[model samples]
Target chain A: MGTIENILIIGGGGMVGQKLAHALAREPLTPGTTSALTLMDLGFPPGSPAGARQITADVSDPAPLRAALAERPAVIFHFAAIVSGQAEADFDLGWAVNHMAFWHFLEAVRQEHLASGGSYCPRVVFTSSIAVFGGPYPEVIDDGFPPAPLTSYGAQKAACELMLADFSRKGFLDGIAIRLPTICVRPGKPNKAASGFFSGIIREPLNGQEAVLPVGTDVRHWHASPASAVGFLRHAARLDTAPLGQRRALNLPGVSCTVEEQIEALRAVAGNDVVALIKPQPDPVIESIVAGWPRNFAPERALALGFRADADFRAIIESYIREDLAPEQAQRLRLR
Target chain B: MGTIENILIIGGGGMVGQKLAHALAREPLTPGTTSALTLMDLGFPPGSPAGARQITADVSDPAPLRAALAERPAVIFHFAAIVSGQAEADFDLGWAVNHMAFWHFLEAVRQEHLASGGSYCPRVVFTSSIAVFGGPYPEVIDDGFPPAPLTSYGAQKAACELMLADFSRKGFLDGIAIRLPTICVRPGKPNKAASGFFSGIIREPLNGQEAVLPVGTDVRHWHASPASAVGFLRHAARLDTAPLGQRRALNLPGVSCTVEEQIEALRAVAGNDVVALIKPQPDPVIESIVAGWPRNFAPERALALGFRADADFRAIIESYIREDLAPEQAQRLRLR
Candidate 1:
C-alpha cells in the first residue's frame, strides 16, 4: 500500500466533498505519520484547513486537471459530478461534466502511468449513485442489475462505470466506484434534487422552519448519513480490491426506511412540535422520480466487505443533531 | 398493420443481410403483391430488378445514408454490423461501424420524422446478437439477465439498444431490435466468427468432409436455423410494437443444446460415416469466447409475441438440408 502522503479532493466545494475534506483533516492517518492535503474547488470556502493549498480551476477542463494531477498525489477522490436532477435538465452540460470529464481524467492518468512505470498508481475513488437504478425492479436490487437506466443521468453514470472497468482491466489505474444511496439529512439548505425533500423535511424542521414533504407518508427510500458516505469513500480508497478482482464498482449498503418512520424519528429527537412542521404536498414530478428509485438494495458484495449504515432512523436523526447542529441546538434533543 | 410495399435492406451485401434479402425475395409478400426492394451496401453485389435500386455508400458517412433514407420506405431491415470477433480485435473499426454509424442513422431518422410531424416514420428492424450476455450466469438465463458484455462488440450492441430505446421513446422513430440466437447449421464456408466452428462441425460433416470440433462435448449453446433468423427479422418489422410499447428490444428465442447433442444430430442425419469424419481439437481461444455467451435464455416475452425457434436439433439439421442444400444433397441424408 502506498502512503497517501498528499491527497487531493476534487469538487471540494460541494457539501459531500467539503464534509469529506473536513473528515480527512480530523482523521489520524496511520499513527506516528502525517501527510499534506490539497483541496480543490471552484473557490475555497470558510473552515478549510489552515495553510491548506487551494486551487480554483474547473475540473471539467483537462489541461487544468492534468496540472492538478501533475502533483502526483497518492490518492484522488473524484467526487465531481452534475447531480441527477440537474444532469437530466441540461443534456449538453451534463455530458460535458459528468461523462466526458471523467473519461478525460482517466485517459490522462492512463497515459501518465504508461509514461512513468513505477510501484505506485494513484487510487481513484469515484462516487456513483443509486440513481443508477430504475423502476420495474425487484424489492431489493443486487450487483447484477442490467443498468436499464430510465434517465440520461443514470445512463451516463453506467457508461462511466463501463469505461472505468475497461480502463482498470487494461491495468492503467487503480479505480474504485462506490454507488452511494441517497444521503439523508444533508447538512445544507435545500437544493434542486427532487429527493432533497426527503432530507428537507427533517433538516428544515431542526432549523426551526416548516418544510414540504412532496410524497405520501408511505414513500420509502434507501439512505446513508454524510459520515457513513465519507466512511464508504475512505474505506473504498483503502480496501484490498484484489478480492474484488474483476468487479471494481460496488453498491454501498444503506438504511432503508419509510416516510412515516422518518417522521417518527424526527419526533423521537425534536418532539411533536418539530414533527408538526412537516406538511404533505404532492408533486407528480417528485413522486415520479422517487417512484423509479429503488427503495432498498441488498448489496450483498458491499455488505460482505463490512460497510455500515445508519443503525436506525433515530440514529440518523441523532447524527444530524450531534454532528451538525450547534451545542445549543443539540441540547434540544438532550431529553431523547 | 402497415403493408410492406416498398422495402429497403441496408448493408445488403453482408452474409446475413444477403441471406435475408434472398429469403424475402423467395417468399410471398402479400396476396398478389410484391415489394419494390432497395439494397444499400458499401459495395452492391451484381443483381438487378428492373425497378429495385441499389446504393453504394459507407454507413459511417451520414450524407449518403441520409439521402437514401429521404425516400422514406415503409419498412427498413437493418442487418449491417461488423461481426463480434473482428470488432473485438479492432477498436476504431468497432466504434465507427457498430456504434457511431447507427447513431448517425438514428439522428437522421429522428430529424426526418420530426420534420414530417410523424407522418413518415418507417418501421426499423435491427438485428442484434446473443454476444450481449457474459459469464457468471445461471443454468437457465432469463430476460432479467444483466448485460455485462465481455467484449467491445457486446458493449456497442448494448449501447445501441439504449439509443434505440431513447429514440423510440421520444417518437423520433419506430424501432425494434431482435437479439438473435447464434444461427446453427450455418450453410457456408467457415468464417472468422469464434462461434463459426459450432456450425462448421455440423455443416462440413454433412457435406462428407472432416471438420474440427474445437470445444468439448459438454459445451452448451443456444441455436436457431438461418431460416428462423430471417423469419425473426421479418416478423419484427411487421409486428405491432404498440404492445411492446417503449420496451422496443426483444430477445428472440433459440434451441439450446450441447456440443455432443449437435454431433448426434449430424450423425442422425448423415449416419456413422459422416460422424466418423469429425475430429476433436480443443482450442482455448474459441472455448473462452463460447464460455462467455449465454447458453440459454428463457425469452417468454418474445414467445408471447409469436417468435419461435427450431423445435429440436434434428429439425434444425433437416431445415438446413431442405432449405439450403440442393435436392440431390438433401437425398444424401440416408439416415433420415
Candidate 2:
C-alpha cells in the first residue's frame, strides 16, 4: 500500500504492459521514493531495464512466476490474454492461456495470501475488454449490462471476472476488473488481431502507408488511447476500492466515434494527404466481428472515480504523431 | 414437442415438486390415457402411486436419472436444490447438489440428444430465482441486468443459467431459466429458508396460529404464488424460444410489496381476529439475508410474452383460498 515498492506485472511483455511499466517508473508515488519493480513477461524488455528488474517467464506454467511472486510484490497487473481471433481459431490454446491460466493465477494468489496469515493480499487489476458486451444492445451500453458474449474469448473473460469477484468477496484477494475499450491509435506494426484493423487503418496511414479499411465507415466503436489504458490500469490498482462496495468490475470510459469521424480526425491532424493513404477493402469477417462490439457506454461509475479519455479524436491523432511518428516522415503536401 | 405426452419431474417430493405434482394430477394432463409420467425424488411420494412412476433416486448420481430419462420424456422439470440456507451452511453439499449435479444433468441431456440425433432434447424448465441479482441497483431490476450474485446459492443458480444458455445455444437441450420471485403464502410448517418468514407470518396466522414476523414490516419484497409459479414453469416449457434468441433466461414478473402491505392484505382476508395471531420478533440474521434480495423488477420482456400474476395481494390471497385450501377450511374464514 505504501508506494507499491515491489511490484509484479503478470504478462508484462504485451503492448499494455510495456506502457504501464514505463508509466509506473515515471510517476511520483507515495513513501517519498520511487519503488523497486519487477516486470515479468514471456519475453524480456527489448533494450535494458528501465529502473527495474526484468524477467522472462511463461505464466501458464507457474513454477517460475510463483518464484517471482515470492518476492511479495505490492501489486499485480494481469493482462495476459489470447486475442479474440486467435482464441476463436484455436479452442485448446484459448482454454489454456485465457481460461485455465487465469484460474492458475488466482490459485497462486490465494495460496500466497493464506501463507501470509491473510495479511498479504496484493491488489490485482485485471484487464477485461468491451467484447464482453455482445449484441441485442440499446445502441449505448452501461456497465450493468449482462455479458452475453458471442465468442469464446468473451465468455472466458466473463468467467474470470466472476471468479475474481468471488475470490475478492471471500477476502482471499484484493481484485479489480477494468473492462477496457479497444485501445485506439495503438502505436505498433499491424498484427493479425481482429481488432488490429481498428488501429491499423489509422496508424499505418499516418506513417505514409496505404492501409485497408476493411469495414464500412458507418461502423461505430468505443476507443481509448494506449496512454489512457495504461492510466486506467494504474488507477485501478491504486484507487480506493471501498467505495465500489460489492461492484468489483467497472467499465473504463472511452471515446465513441464512427469510422468516418476517425478519418476526419486523422485528416485534421495530419492533413488530407495523410487521410487519402487509406483504401476501402471490405472484409465480411472483420465486419461481422466489428458489428458485434459495443459502440458506446455510459461509464458513470469509472468517470465518477476520475478515470478519463482523450478530449477528442483529433487529440488521439495528435498524441500518436507526437509519440510514434518520426520527425522526418513525408506526406504529399510536405514533399512539395 | 408432440403434446409432451411423457413428462419427468426430478426431486418430485419436495415442497415445489409436491405442489407441482398435485397441480398436474388435478389437471390430468392426458386424462385416461396410457401416457406414462415419472416423478423421481430422494424420498418416496406420500401415497402409493400405482399409476405414476415414483423412484427414490439421488440426482447427483446420474445412473438413476439417466435410466429414468431413457424412457424418452418429452419434458423435464428440474426443481432440485439444497435450499439457500443449507447450501450456504455446508460447502460440500452446496457443490454437490447445487453446482455439480447441474452439469451432470446437462451432460446427460447432451448424451440424450446425441443418441436421438436431435429427435428428443427434452424441454427443460428450471426454476431459477431472484437470488441471482445482487446489490448495487436502481428502483426496478431489468432482465438484461448483470448478475452479481452475493451468495453461494445465487452464484450456483447463475452458473446453471449460463450452462443452460450454452447448452441451448449448442442445440443440446431446449432450456429456459425462469427467475421466480420468492414464492409467498407457502402452506407448510416453517423451515430454515431465510426467506421463509416472508411466508410464515401470513400463512401460519391464516391457519389460526401465531407467526413470528421477523425483521420490520416496512421491508419490501417481490413475490409470486405457488400456482402462478407452476404456471410459469408450464408456459416457459412451451413458449417460442426463437425470439429469446441467444439469451435463454427470462426474469419472470412478480408482485412487489412492503411487509406492512402484506400484513394489511392478510388482515383484509382473515380480519383483525387473524391478524392478532401475528407477533413481531426482530431477528438480525433474517434481516441481513432479506436485505440483499431485489425488491422489484421491470420484467418488460416477460410481460410482452403474456405471463400473468395476481393483480393485487387480495387476488393472491383469494387464489390460495380457492385452490390450496379445502371448502370446509375456506368456510372457517367466515368471509370476515
Candidate 3:
C-alpha cells in the first residue's frame, strides 16, 4: 500500500507526456500503490488512455499546481513549456511558462511539505534538453561542462536544472532531470523548434511527402527514438538517485551521427525511394540556430547508471516504424 | 555628459560595495559623464562617499529598484545579497533576497529597456562567488566545471548566475558575473560566514589577540584581497563582454593556498610571534561547511582578460596591513 499510487503528468497533452502516461499505464509504478493517474494539460489530449482523470488546466497558473499537489501525488512528471523557437520569439511568455511556472511549482511542493510537517518528498522527473548546451565547444561535451545555453529555451531549462538540484538538496522534493538528445522521427506535425526539421525530414518522407534538408548533410548531431526517450523517463522515475548527489541532471545517452549518416541509415532500411524524397535546401535562419546547438555529448554518468538509447540510427528508424504508422501505411511507406 | 552620467551600486552598504564606491569616486567612469552614484541597501552604510546619493530600502521589493532606475544609471553594480550563513538560517529570505530579488531586478532593467524604445542596455556587473562550487574532489576547478552548490546560499548564487547569462543573451543587459574568491584578512570584526576564519585567523592574530583556527591547517582554498575584488568590479564594469559570447560569468583569478601555507606567509611577513597568536579549536559546524567549499580554481578566463590578484599569500597579508590596520595597530602588529 505504501508506493506511488497517485500520479500526475503536468503536460499530459504533449507528445512526451502522452507517451509517459501510456508507459505508466502499461506498467504500474511499484505495483501496489500506483492506482490512479491525474493527467493535466492546457487541453485534454484526443483519445487518452483509460483510468486517468483527465484535466485541462493551464499549469502556468499556480491554481493547477495547488490542485495537483492537493492530491498529494506520489510522482510528478513536469514536462510543460513552450518550445525553443517560441521561447526565443516571445520573451515574457517564455519567462512565465518556462521559468516562473516551474519555480512556483517547486515552491508549492515545498510549501505542501512544510504544511505536512516535513514528510512529503515527491519524486519529480523533469525533461531537460541538449539546448542547455551552446557551441564553439569541444567535439565531445561531457557531464562536467557548465551550461552555456545560447537560446532563451536552453537558458530557461538550464536555470530550472539548477533549481531542481537545490530543491532536492534541501529535501523539499526528490528530483531527477534528464537532458534529452534530439528525438528523431517525432510522430507529430512540424512545429517551430529549430530541431523540428530533424524529425520532419524523416517523418515527412516516410509519409510520401518531400522533405527539406536545411543544413548540410555533413553536420553531426545526437539522436534517440521516442521510445528510447520514454524509456529514459521511466528509468529516471525509479532509479536510486543518491549516487547522483548534488548534480541532479544527467545527460541521457544517444546515438551520435551526421545527417549524411542518418540519411544513409534510412536508405539502408527503406532503399533509394526514401533518399530521393529529401530536397537539398540551405536555410540560413535554421542553419544559424542549429549551428550553436551542441553536436555531441559524452554521457558517461547516465550510461553507467543503466539508461540506454538506440545503438544506431538504423535501430532508431526501426523503432519508429515498429511503434508508429499503420500496417498499410508502413507497406506504402516502404514502397514509396 | 554623453557617456555614463549616472551609476547605481545595489549593495553599496556591504564591504565590497563600499570599496567599489570609493574606487569609482577616485576615478570617473568614462572620464567625464559619470556624474552621480545612487547607493542603496537595507540601511545606509556609515559615511557614504561624496557625490553618492544614498538610499535605504529593501531591494526584494521592486519600489527601490524602480526609484534607482529612475536615475537611468548607465552602470549597475549588483552586489546586494544576503550572505551565506544568513541565507542558510532563513530559507524564505534567502530565496527572496538572493534569487527572486536578483531576478526581479533584472526584469525591472529589461522593462526599463522596453519602455525606452529598445535602446537602454546598462552594463551590469554582478558579484558572484566561488561558493557556487561544491566539491567531491577536483584539485583545480576550471572554467568548464558545472556548479553543484552544496549550500542554499551557493545554490541561490548559481541560479542567479544562470539567469544573468540568460538576461544578457536576450539583450536585456550587458551583464558579466565574476565569481570572486574568499577575501582574506578582511578589515572588519568577524561575522558568521563559514569563511570568516580565513580573515579572522590572520586579522586577530595581527591585532595581538588569539584567533580560533576552526579547521586543520592543511585545508586549502582560494583568496584575493578586498582591493583586488573591487578592482575586478571596476574592470568588469568596462570589459569587452562580446568575447564572452553566450557564457556571461567568469571565475576571477585569485591566489590559492592552504591554511598552513597562510600561517607560513604570516610568519614570513610578521615573524613567528604573530603566527603564534592563532589558537587551534575545531568547530564542527564551520568545519563541515568549509569542507564542501572549493579548494582551488584555474581561472584562465579572468587572468587572460587582465584581472589580477595579490602575488602571494604574503602579499595578501601585507595588503591587508596597508589598507585595513590603523597606523598604531600596524606598528603594534609589526612589533608583536
Instruction: List RMSD in Å for every model shown.
Output: 3.9, 4.6, 2.0
Error of 1 at A62 (Å): 4.1
Give the proportion of true interface contacts each model preserves, from 0 to 1. Answer: 0.24, 0.29, 0.74
lDDT of 2 by residue, A1-336 (tens): 444478788777877787778777877334465757777777864743467787777779889878877777788889888888888776557756886688678878877888899998888899988777779788788766788877767766876777677667767788999999888888777655788887987888877798999999999998888888887888888888888877788888989999999999888777787888899999999899888888999999999998988887777777777666666763443563
TM-score for the A chain of candidate 1: 0.95
Could you tell me the C-alpha RMSD of candidate 1 in Å?
Answer: 3.9
| Best candidate (score: lDDT) | 3
Sequence-dependent TM-score of model 3? 0.96
**What TM-score, computed on C-alpha atoms, does each candidate reach?**
0.87, 0.83, 0.96
Q: Scoring each candidate complex against the real one, what DockQ results?
A: 0.34, 0.33, 0.70
> In candidate 3, which residue ranges exceed 4 Å CA deviation?
A1-4, A32-34, A334-336, B1-4, B32-34, B271-273, B334-336
Q: In model 2 chain A, where is the ten-residue run with the lowest total lDDT?
A: A327-336
Query: Which tens-of-lDDT digit does each residue in B223-251 have in candidate 3?
Result: 99998888888899989998888778899
Model 2 CA lDDT for position A247: 74
Binned by DockQ into CAPRI classes (incorrect, acceptable, medium, high), candidate 1 is acceptable
What is the lDDT ranking, best to worst? 3, 2, 1
